[model samples]
Target: MWWYTFAHVVYHLIRWFPKNNRLKIRIVIVLFSFGLLFPQLFVLSREHSTRYCGQHLFDFLIVSIVFTFFMIGFSFIFSLMDPVPWEVKLAFHIFGVIAFVMGLTLTVFASLAVDCRNNTLELYYLSVSAAVLTVTSFAFLMVMIPFWLLNYFFPNSVLNRKERTGVCYEPTACCSCLWHI
Candidate 1:
């Protein structure tokens, strides 16, 4: 669908967020999260509630979708920030991978729990999967919080010029808007 195409374009452009633009990165993350999350909320809300639990579970799915979407979008930025400390980059990547694995686990569990054709929910197992997904998403966000704050305040990043291998590129409006072009 158009979602896949939009994500593909974002995946390509996110890599261009300069290593020094930690502030920009943080801002973009917030904005992107907001843009995607709200539309998802509206759509999910329009979906009929088969049961209270089912409605809630669907909301849970929306949360998982939003966080996973942001993580995937930011994966490119984290990978390209060569000027960042190894510790920071390693931490983000490790947590990101864990989030992905847990998300996959949740998806498989959810699918197995739902009898789509019958329009029935295996309430127990689906709830369990949602719980697991929630915990993983919470952990991932916690890990990212420190990094985002550091970047927001420092603007430069976790390392100085002498420690990193290459110069960090400063984001300019035009350069950062390569996605638009």
Candidate 2:
């Protein structure tokens, strides 16, 4: 479901440009890798340490969102290759790098400083940051979606059903029949 949602959003966001379905897949994989899977795995595997430096579960969530933005920003920068002019692409890439670093630095600092006595202010700022990213990421994800099926957005034609690979059914589908009441 998350993969579908991401694909839909990315299709639209990248539609104006030439469709490199492979690149889109790669970008989504990268996004989910850094944004969702990595963090979840980190928290689950790490024995629930409460130390701020160790990054509690909540801090991992924040870091996940921060990493998602970084992934999106980098993907966007990469998508500009060959299509956009060199000067503009270079400029945007530099800006994207700066933004990624700044966001990661700030989020890491918040995660680390969360144990400090003056932490109310830190948590408040992190909450505000999280909220802002939450909205922007969703908005941009929507931006990322579908101009997919719409042909004007594509450089090449969409493939016909017969032209594409056939859908394969799982053998496990018959095993489920055995359990039916």
Candidate 3:
């Protein structure tokens, strides 16, 4: 739906950004998408809980989703500097990927377990739908993060940084930096 549209936009936009900022932007988008999708999972859990385990699981999901969304928002707002080191970028990317995978796995497993008790098809559908969305979002994030990181860390290899800074068009052929432009 609209999420796919947003993802597509993000995908293309990442191509134009400097490499280092690309990963950061993807991570932000992934976090924002997670925040956007959490409510659907919460509502599904609420409707299908018959046992105490279901309630516990629902509570756990709510807490996890809230905490994740908070962290993503905080990180996005705080990290504005350019050329983040490779190690820091890798760490964030790894953390986000692991968290996303684990969360989706847990949701799927819990949904299947609940389905056993309730014999309801809706639970299965909800679980599968959530998994699909989670996977799609994560896949987009994976592509964008690495692409941006490569660009940022190795700008000269792929893009002409001098041209981007407007130094190539100078008429005087001066050795001065592009800051004058």
Every model's TM-score: 0.37, 0.28, 0.44
Q: Mind giving the per-residue lDDT tens digits that candidate 3 earns over 68-179?
A: 5544443543344334467755655565555675556656665555534454344444445555656677676565566456656766433344565322334324543322
1-181 per-residue lDDT for model 1 (tens digits) = 1222233344445556665665666567557656655544454554442344433456555545665465555544544555557786565556556655655555555555544323433443444545554565556556556755776687657423345421123332326342321
Worst window of 10 by summed lDDT in candidate 2: 163-172
**Alpha-carbon lDDT of model 1:** 0.49
**Number of the top-ranking candidate, with lDDT as the measure:** 3
Winner on lDDT between 1 and 3 is: 3
* lDDT of prediction 2: 0.44
Q: Against the true structure, what is every candidate's RMSD? A: 11.9, 15.2, 10.2
lDDT of 2 by residue, 39-136 (tens): 44444344433334433434644554555554455455444443556785465446445544544445555455544424343343443454455445
Which parts of model 3 are misplaced by more than 4 Å? 1-60, 75-97, 107-126, 159-181
Q: Which ten residues in a row have the lowest lDDT in candidate 3?
A: 172-181
Using lDDT, rank the candidates from best to worst.
3, 1, 2
